[model samples]
Target chain A: MSQIIKQEKKRSFVTAPTAALLSLLLPGLGQILARRVQRGLLMFGALVSIVGLLVWRITLLGRLAEGFWPTLFKSLDRAPMFVAFGLLAIAGLWLWIVIDAAKQTNPNRQFGNSIFVLILVVFFTIGWQISEIDLVKLSSDANEAWVPLSKILWPWEAAVTHDTDTVEAGAKVLVDSEGQAPPVPEKTEGEPYLRVSPRKGELSKLDEDNQVIPGTKITVYGENFEPNTRTQIWWSDSIGNEFRPRYQGEYVSVMTDSEGSFEKELIMPYRLIPPSAKGQQIHKVMARQVSQVGPPLPSQPLILTIELIIETIFMGMMATIFGIIFSVPISFLAARNLMSTSWLTLTIYYLTRTVLNIVRAIEPLIWALIAVVWVGLGPFAGIVALTIHSIAALGKLYSEAIEGINPGPIEAIQATGANKLQTIMYAVVPQMIPPFVSFTIYRWDINVRMSTVIGMVGGGGIGFLLVQYIRLLEYKSAGIAVWFIALTVAILDYVSAEIRQKFV
Target chain B: MLEIKNLTKIYPDGTLALDDVSFTVEDGEFLVVIGLSGSGKSTLLRCINRLIDPTKGQIIMDGQDITAAEPSELRRIRRKIGMIFQHFNLVDRSSVMTNVLSGKLGYINPWASLLHKYPPGAKKEAMAALEKVGITDQATKRADELSGGQRQRVGIARALMQNPSMMLADEPVASLDPVLAHTILGYLEQLNSESHISVICSLHYLDLVQRYATKVIGLRDGQVVYRGDREDIRKMTDGQFKEIYGEEAVRVNAGEFDQGEK
Candidate 1:
């Protein structure tokens, strides 16, 4: 019996290597050696299917190429179906290979499957190279050819209406430069020197076809303007009317030449202009200019709308600061190891989680609106909204990190005469630092994205500018704002990824 | 240095783990507690250090009643006594040096320890302890990377780092092979002789206790069935051994004895 047992062990040792070598030559060969013929055949079938699908896709593309653009464009619309089928076939083949590898009894069979997988990987790479598409050129051509007919309408011209030759009350207007108004004194209490122009009657009324179209031009003439003085120009439609302000041609500060002349072309509210009143009525025009340096010269109160770019940047920074500050303490309460009692832990956990869910559930814009009502419209309202949401989200993540720490050191510290606080400081805090830094970076990324959204509701950021542009139907300007936001998010993601990699 | 008076421990599950156990170990005595699995040997050792609170007993160590001490006072008392586990319980991810430095935590202020700002004297003492254990060269290596015997040596160094008056080792060698087990026991014996520190170790192998233990205590079903010197334990009759262990175990030991002759 002893001799027979020894002989069997020796046989296994020798056959194991031999079986492995055979399996290494072809996929499923080891399974065949192990007497699993059905499994081997299944693996073989899967390999054949993958190769067949690749060949079919390549051949179909080749046939389409024979006729070039005509056939290719026709077939391009159906390309998604072919891609989906190819993906399914690939998935099926992979699953079969994995199952066969696992069910294989002999080590030799596993070795064979490994080599087979390696070969297939090389083949798949070659297939991918053959299937590559020139997507870059295609996208560029599409962009160049497709111009919507809406561009021809020139909607900005129809944005305003005015009375005939009479500057009526509440009529949309522009500043008229031809007036020889007196120079308004600096810090003047009453109205300052200003030029007012009516919206032209010719463009104010619709044609016989009944399409509303409007056009107007007004210029500002001023004296004693410094050669480099910066000026802003804006216009507002009738109050309480639904004519939303157009954001086109808004300049931060148009510098006056040495002659004190600043000319700007303004487009009417093309995107958000309200429908013209039933009858033509007079509208007011207002214009004022201020120096970039010192206090504004007592200029007429310009009715032109002002967009505050600096305030937007300030609001975003303040919100981020407060968010980080409030999140720190709440996170400690939520950590499980620091809070030993399960009841206390559960209470804080649920409370923080619920608050975070509620904060995240409402868009930051909604929060900003509510905050504006509470705190008045300013950066303060935006800061409050971001702070509350950050605490909830950051607290949950920080607490989870604390709970996942190795309990050994905590126990060791507790085993000493140290109190609970001391134990946490010595054991829990050290372990939590790497993850905390990582979470902070991620939160910064999230905060930047959120800051843009909150700006739309007067919270003050780039989003507020974006909203103004979109409301005016200036898609090009709106596109610029969107591109900036996307680029910022991508850059932040890359930076945070680099930082996280260091910790890992 | 340590004394127990009629200690008893009945777990919440209604299982009586230790019952009316009593013993005393004088200063510098190398005492070994021996029993089979589930024999209350571990319970008896843990009770001495108050690692597990006894249900109905008093533990008098250095003339103070440790069992009735307040929580803070109990912690203070525990600081003076070092305990080693079978698993070593070293922080696996930390360096061997850090694991040894943790033993000095009981003496240093917690904030100081948290910042890893041990006094120069403490650092010297830690180095000395590591040197005594012959693992000074592996001070910076992670504890998990060491072999079982080397890890156990580091555990001993950590315990010594406490500078405790009494040491308790529970199944310290149960995970080691026979030769390494003997080497560790020899180290423990040497520490006891040189430092005059009272040593109480629980051991599973009967032959091991017979070889190195100056005093042997036998436990059975939570009761101290035998308490005497090693010579007296070896002279116990087959019937007495059968009474503590079952007949099958006594017969097994007898077979081992016969096998040794070969």
Candidate 2:
């Protein structure tokens, strides 16, 4: 009988190689043979679910893995690199499990410690692979970003331009190449009895025959200047120092005609006196061709930054106020103690708590998107979004505060034969006020910070303007917005701290 | 006078806190109930005031059946029955005056109470109650600001606001220091004798029960096992004590009578 028993035992027994081979067939088959039924099932579940997750993630990316064969190849090409990396992670974990199972029939009792190393390896490798972590990208991208980033960090130049045209003039007489004013012209005989010495037809205005006044236009004509070049007419003082007449802010240039000569009416400046000619003023017209020019700075965008910062602060404050109004009563419903007396109350308690949790779980930015759709994009949308999020956060805090108050007072009030409402007024509300004030101030502080994020999603605050500036490549304006936001938040944080300190 | 006729109270969890227990208290008598922790002493006192409804019984005070009182009727009945507690359950956040004034809620107008505006006349009465308990100075202080003895005084003053004819103190001195126990009970004693108000108080120590009880009822397992006047309990035998207090129970002050038997 003993020999028969031994023979039966040998037939049922599993060796290391057999166990390893079994695990190769199915994830936890070897562990099952080793009589670790619970562990085997758990490992099997994990392997199957992780593979299922990988397939799901692949499908979610629109890699339709149709018809097992063609999809097997094409889907791999279409799926993100993460799926392949995930498969590798599972392969590593499975290999570790197979080797571990082969070492003993009855493996280590503590499943977590025994398998922790492989589990960590799987998680980190998949995380690293899926995220496409590449330090080289950061290094290469940093160099490209430095040009704009440095300019943003370095505050912009806002200097005013003060440029003018220089002019000089000298009076000239109408003379021929002999350099002498007309004298007796040629044998003045026939006309000697009755003739004025007449010039040919008429001398041009280039000879300065017209008188000019400040703030009035005068005709100035010139010939033989650079062709098609930008030229400016200047006012020449009696001291021979020439300057352009200021039309609006700076000198306005006129282009020369293609024939290398130009004629135009020019406006006189409001003031034309030079240092040497302060008492006695005289003027002359001079023209020069300009080759290059610069533009005056625009200050419209700078003023816009300041307006947005104020809007962001008010948006946060409004949201916090709305949150407080809605959350105070709702918190009492969520409090476990008040609702513990009846089954109906307990149900309402749990329902209120679940709703709060669900609302809180959704981020304020996502809420902002919904609010933008509802309210049509502005600080109003931001306020509504922030209010919804803050209600959930502050409700949870207030409920916890209610739950934490000592029950002695409540029972004491009840024993006085007071009604429910009286008990709450006399006892519960007092205990709640201090923590309520503190939490409210804290929530307002949080909401102010949240408004910046809401603005990024087009909820209309400084964050909205900040994103616009960055997108439009106006880094200087964006930098100004950042400064406004940082300074406002920091100051509010300190002020709220002092307020909370007083209440607490 | 108060009468508890076959009073039975079963808690919501089906605990038979009091099972067919019956007792009575004459007007102006100090009736002390002695029992173990769960011996139905608290249930009996609460049932008389209908703070806890009896499962099957009749609680009669003066000619009214308290157990059958309506919601509005119960409040009126409760106004006359002042209840004190082991923890001196004053609203700790409220002013001591407010805590005392709440005892007059059953007598005040419901609308006025809802508005939390008590009559000035009621305020004067609450002050008088505080004066009676020697805690008139603590009237404006928050209830939690006082020592245990002072808090119990506040509790007593709150009960006095109703001008109650009977007081139910359920282990009132249980949470007090051993030395301060009699001091708290002394005020209850004065209320019973001088004001002619009946008191049904539960007590722990046998020596205290003997000192203050005009009459005593010993309960064991929610059943009345011993009954006596003040003098009879003072000389109670070990066998009688064991019947209510249980075997292996040696009185802390039992002295030679217990030592001789052991």
Candidate 3:
């Protein structure tokens, strides 16, 4: 009988690994190899169903080209074909493990340990395959390319431009004589005339000679200009219209040298002329200097400056400071350590918590609006909103932190003839520092992000610029603004994390 | 130093934890109240400090009736009479020094205490108490970090920090092993001897009680079944032990008592 038992054990041991191998090739095949056909089919069916669902969803979303579908199908599409092949493989593997587990004989019971390890290995292998099988990625090339492309194209830019003709007297100018200027002069009498003179246009006035006149002469000089280039000039007499070149004269334009310094003689327009009879007007002018070829003008730099970001940072900092100052004392009332039986303390705790929850529940923008109504617009409103919200949020967190402190020290301090307040200072406060620092830093991070958001409602931040860009349909600039915000938030998160780790 | 008259405690669940029990402990006496588990041992001890207020009794300590005292007055009384628990009830996270200092809290103003400006003397006193318990070296260590024996010593130090006229130890060594248990009892005995501070200790170990107690009191189902000298206890008959511990207890101890410490 003992000989027969030994032979049976040997046979089972030999088959276990083969069964495990079969299961690895196809899920549940090991169970079938182990003579549990029902369980094997159940597992096989579940895996196929899940894979099918994933593939179907991926295809529905038009992500098939990413190979998500194909991978899943390859693993499952040839239902009968792959299933039979996979089942056979898994059955072989399972048989191997079982046989190995059975072959170990020990009077000391170490055989149980070996069997457990083998079982763990088999489960781990099955799990790995399930996780690695990518049905969606197998379906579509488009999705495959788009997924990675989307990450790289996270931010986009757009250009915005506005035209302006006003020029500062000493600043450089562009002279466009043929386009939108006074009619060209017909060389009438020999009044030695200057053409295209470097000139400053008088504000809301006409010049002598019935032509719109330029203002004070500022020497417009450049490397390419001759000393005589500033001599010839042109003027216009149209009221409220600045001087314009009647002819492409020497004084009509001025170009700066490599050092950006220029010298030019400009005809000053008379300011004594009546302004426009209808409304306020601005006189315009251009200074051009003739050269062998016109020097390339520099393109105007795109400016996307916003004061809202600065305002938000300031508001957030102020709010955090005020919040800390105001909330710390209130937190003591809520802490069970300091006041154990005072109903007044309990009331204060709930009241502060409720107010805080209400403040937090409403978005910061709404708070900004409310604050604006109460305190008026600008940083003051933002500060008030952030401070109010911070008090509630910081209060709750601080109280909980105070609560978690070990009671032993409090009791010890109490035993020392220290009163309630003394115990709190010596016992509770010391233990609370770590969590308090951590929570405060985290709150500041959130406040920074919130500061930007609150700017949309005029609370003052980069959000204002983002709103304007979005409204103006400058999505590219808006994208740039969004990038700034995201970058700021990420940096803050990292910095805060570092600070919390170091201090807390 | 302390008087407990007609003290009875009934839990809210309608269970009679202590039935109209009355006892008076003289100053400087090492009084050990012995009983099996759930025999009003702890309830009787807590009643002295009003930690667990007796339902129908008056505790007159130092000529003041505490049973009718206001919350503030009760707190004042509590400060003067320190109570130790079986679990040592030391805040586990606090340093040993801090736990000892808490006993002096009742003497300082709340706001002053909040600032941790314990009069310099209080600090010295706290350290002295720790020294008394022989755990002065562990003053900076967290209470939980200490061994069970050390933790209980801290508990004693905490009680001593109160500078009370009387100390109430409710099964102080019930949680310790035999050796640690004896060491703690020895400390309490030594404290009683040197300070002449009245002590009312509840205990389960009959051996310890017989060894250290000047007087013995036994309770059965919230009623005092035996009260008197240690000599009177030694003369108790099998019937009396049965009355206190029930008949099943008698049968189990019939043979064991022969070898058991009387």
Candidate 4:
């Protein structure tokens, strides 16, 4: 160490002092003066890039600030920790570069880059804060995710329903004294019966503030119902529209006694009658007891899920068939090896490649949106969208496969005095079969996955139903669609793998 | 008979592949070409069949200028001249019988060949050619399934199906073992002697050149530097050998080592 310090002191005063002074002004200037051009440039570039990144981040954090200085200060106020560390890193780098510049002029001293690593660690920490990485929230908010995740994981309960048999009896009631009420029907044996006392009553009405006012209460008597069974009270308006009436925030229901008889009281429900009616509006009050019967059947969501999933699969199949038909020819035009023979053919190759790239760059959902307008929202539109995208994707893949083929057989075939078409048929076509089949199968797999998503843009598949269920807050039903898509994609992936293995 | 006059091929990249090369081969002559890699040996052989169009040359075969033939006429001449490669360029996925039958494509109807419906006797001809190379039983196997020697035999069979007037072998034995090299060359020799087919083949080893060549030409830097008859080749002096190969080139013992190989 002493020898190094003594050698550093003994260095030529003229060049060494000038080099150190130049490096103090700019971080890499001394190194450049020492003829370390590459190392100096690298140091300069790293310093500029890191400082530039820090400035960009600061600007992003304070975008709403008025001007440059205010924005910088405002960003510091908002993210003090990131800004503080960023400034500290810049200062540390500046000091380190100044020391390093002086050290570069000393022949006996070895330069160390450990300070650069320290600067990087400081900036990386600032980046973590700027990106808002929060592992605490990830675990803390997991319950919120699980609420829907559980529904998605197991949704079969909503997929089925039980058939039920109802035993019901009704009694008529008058809405007001302005019209006459219907007479009560005679009670019969071995059947349920309901009778309402003092049937003439006012229906619940909205007041001046539109707040609901409770109507008159009436006692209801029931008999011949199933013993110890719960019976619900339902009301029908003058037009025969039936709905369960809520009493005190709960549906009006009562349990029958052991003798199959009971009595209960319920306020009249609110109903608006049109002024055009000439006679009394007799609303019916009914007591109904329900019993589940037979096996569970598929619910509407389950049936719709199955139907749309099948449509999605067929859309993929049709798209793949159309893609294979169109892409096969286009691939020949796009293959560089085949088209590079002449400038005219080379132009066609570039044109085809550019068009394929443009078409493939657009997502299938975007194509589906355009196709929905063209074909008016059906599986055919989804097929058209997927086919358009598939053609571009498969064309590029097939052309690459063509480019990768062994040229030996092609030369051999040409030497046999075969025509151009005959050469392709015998030499290129045989070599292309395995790859063609593999790519086609792989494309079909992609098309199937894309078809499910295309339906969300009105292209007619399970995704349409899935979006509707999600918007309606039907998590279990959306779960069914998600499950179907996942299962179908997995199965198709396996099938394609098997087919590829068999052929390739 | 064949005649090549002042054949010169300059590639688009300005590579002088063949520089004013001139040679002649009469009927029933086994002419062997010896050279280092990139010495225009393959280029010279390919020029005879018009596979590589010469930049400037005259390839006169039976009073017809092959280099000046149109596409249709060139193909007609190419079918009469069979060529084999060092790599045995058979379609790996195709059956040996199919590969051999394809050699008759020049004579078959275009549409019929496209549909793979050859003339009735074409299969018989392919089998006969295969039998000539002693691989008729392996005709049903795919070309890639065969051993190196067997694949070369298949190549020979495919070439024989053309019934050509001459054969061009471009380093046909380079990729095979020394023993297999003699086996493949023996087949070419049998066809040459039995059918009077003029054979123009490029070879690497000096012993093989001396054993099979009725006449020999050596090339260096795409120019012919040495010519000798069978007896003259057997008695070639070191100075003559150095004239064809560079001064730094040393001939290793007998058939065990390659000479002037890259």
Tens-digit lDDT track of model 1 for A246-282:
4343442356667654454434333233455433332
**Model 4 lDDT at residue A207:** 94
Compose the digit string of candidate 3's lDDT tens values, residues B1-262: 6677788899978989888788777889889887778989887876776656789988888789988887677777778777777878776656787777777778766766555567889889988998887888999997779998889989888888788778788888878776677678778878888988888898765556666788878888898888877686566555665566666663221122223222
Which 10 successive residues of model 2 chain B have the least lDDT summed?
Answer: B253-262
User: Tens-digit lDDT track for model 3 on A11-116?
Assistant: 2222555665666667666655554445456556655654454344334433334565464455455343433344454455445434433332211222223433
- Clash number for every model? 11, 2, 115, 0
C-alpha RMSD over true interface residues, each candidate: 2.7, 2.2, 4.1, 0.9
Instruction: List model 2 lDDT by residue over A1-504, tens digit each.
Output: 243223322221477788788888897788677665555676777777677766655555445556654555564676546657676778877887787557546333233345755565556655564576887898988888886677567634421232443221222222111234333223332221111122111222222554433344455554555568777666554456666766566685667678655566545444423335333233345566544335654355556766777788888889999999999889989999889999999999999999999999999999999999999889999999999999999999999999999776665555556667766776688788879989998988888888976899889888898898889987777777777778888998999999988765
Candidate 4 lDDT: 0.87
Tell me, by lDDT, which candidate is best. 4
Q: TM-score per model for chain B alone? A: 0.91, 0.92, 0.90, 0.94
lDDT per residue, candidate 4, A1-504, as tens digits?
Answer: 344344443443336667667766887787676655555676777778778888888999889899999998999998897888888888887777767767767666665768668867866876787688988999999899997889988999999988999999999998865766678768997888899987789988889999999898899999999989999999998889999999878999999999888899999988777778767778899999999889999999999999999999999999999999999999999999999999999999999999999999999999998999999988999999999999999999999999999887777777878888888888888999999999999999999998888888999888899999988988999999999999999999999999999876
DockQ of 1: 0.21
Global local distance difference test of model 3: 0.64
Stretches of model 2 off by over 4 angstroms after superposition: A1-13, A38-98, A106-115, A139-310, A328-353, A390-411, A487-504, B106-140, B237-239, B248-262
Q: Pick the DockQ winner.
A: 4
DockQ of each: 0.21, 0.37, 0.21, 0.62
Q: Which candidate is the best by TM-score?
A: 4
Q: What ranking of all candidate models by TM-score puts the best one first?
A: 4, 2, 3, 1
Q: Cα RMSD (Å) between model 3 and the true structure?
A: 13.5
DockQ of 4: 0.62
With candidate 3 superimposed using the best TM-score fit, by how many Å does residue A428's alpha carbon deviate from the native?
6.2
Measured with C-alpha atoms, the lDDT of residue A298 in candidate 4 is 95
Per-residue lDDT for B43-148 in model 2, tens only? 7877787667899989888989988988767777877888888988777767888788888877777678767789879989988888877778888897878999
